[model samples]
Target: MEFDELQDLARGVRQKYAAREHENYGRTWSREEIMLGFLGDVGDLAKLVQGKEGVRPREDLDEAFAHELADCLWSVMTLADSYGVDLEEAFVSTMTELNGVLDET
Candidate 1:
């Protein structure tokens, strides 16, 4: 699916979590809280990457690696949505700039 579609799906997932938070914690997570969660996911993803590279041992291996990466992506999409960022546009623009810099080298 497109990035926008994926972001919409992430929003739906966030809504479900929000409802649960309201029931369990009496409040949904703030944007900063969500960003912290994203940071946790990033840490998990880094470990998975290390395992995949043979720098660390991991029994779960393949499935955990892919899952953690997806989790990180979901967090990124949700965070971008929260900030009103057009991630697709931002990604393309950033990559274009990077490519330009690489070509200049």
Candidate 2:
């Protein structure tokens, strides 16, 4: 899928979570709360990475790692949407700048 399509799918999932949060907690998560949740996802991904390296043993580590990475991507896409940033553009620009810097060296 294209980036826009993926981002739309992410937004759909994020809306579902907002509805669940409202039902459970009387309000959806704030931006800060979302960031905190993203941090938790990152921590999980880190542990999964450790498992992949055999530093932390885990059953089904590959599956867990893929899931965690997806979660992190969802968080990043959601955060970018919330902040009104065009992630695709930013990513391309950043990569171009990095390549330019590398070429200069």
Candidate 3:
């Protein structure tokens, strides 16, 4: 999706959460909500990987994990938007700089 569309989606999701803030688990998320969501999703990701030995070896993703990952991405995009950063450009520049550093090393 385009940046504009992603921004719209972020707005919609934020609005949805706002509408049910006090009802659903007593959540009244603000802009910091995005950061908290991102951190929570990251923790979930770590949890999923932490017990690889005990967990069954499977390629299929657990539904909740997928949802958490999507949530993480959405929050990240929102954060990027808040900072006026175009992720596409930053991503490219970061990779390019890494490559240059690698070549130098």
Q: Which candidate leads the pack in lDDT?
A: 2
Tens digits of per-residue lDDT, candidate 2, 1-105, equal 999999999999999999999999999999999999999999999998899998998788999999999999999999999999999999999999999999999
TM-score of 3: 0.65
Clashing pairs in 1: none
- lDDT by residue for model 1 (1-105), tens: 877788888899999999999999999999999999999999988988898999987798999988988888888888888899999999999999999999999
> What's each prediction's TM-score?
0.92, 0.97, 0.65
Query: Against the hidden true structure, what lDDT does model 2 obtain?
Result: 0.96
Give per-residue CA lDDT, model 3, range 3-101, as digits (tens): 668778886886787779868868676668768878988887766554344464445446655776777778887788777888868978999999999
- Where does candidate 1 have its weakest 10-residue lDDT segment? 1-10
Each model's backbone clash number: 0, 0, 0
What's the ranking of the predictions by lDDT, best on top?
Answer: 2, 1, 3
- Score each candidate by Cα lDDT: 0.91, 0.96, 0.74
Candidate 1 local distance difference test against the native: 0.91
- Evaluated with TM-score, which candidate comes out highest? 2
User: Order the candidates by TM-score, highest first — what do you get?
Assistant: 2, 1, 3
For model 3 the local lDDT of residue 83 reads 75
RMSD of each: 1.2, 0.6, 3.7
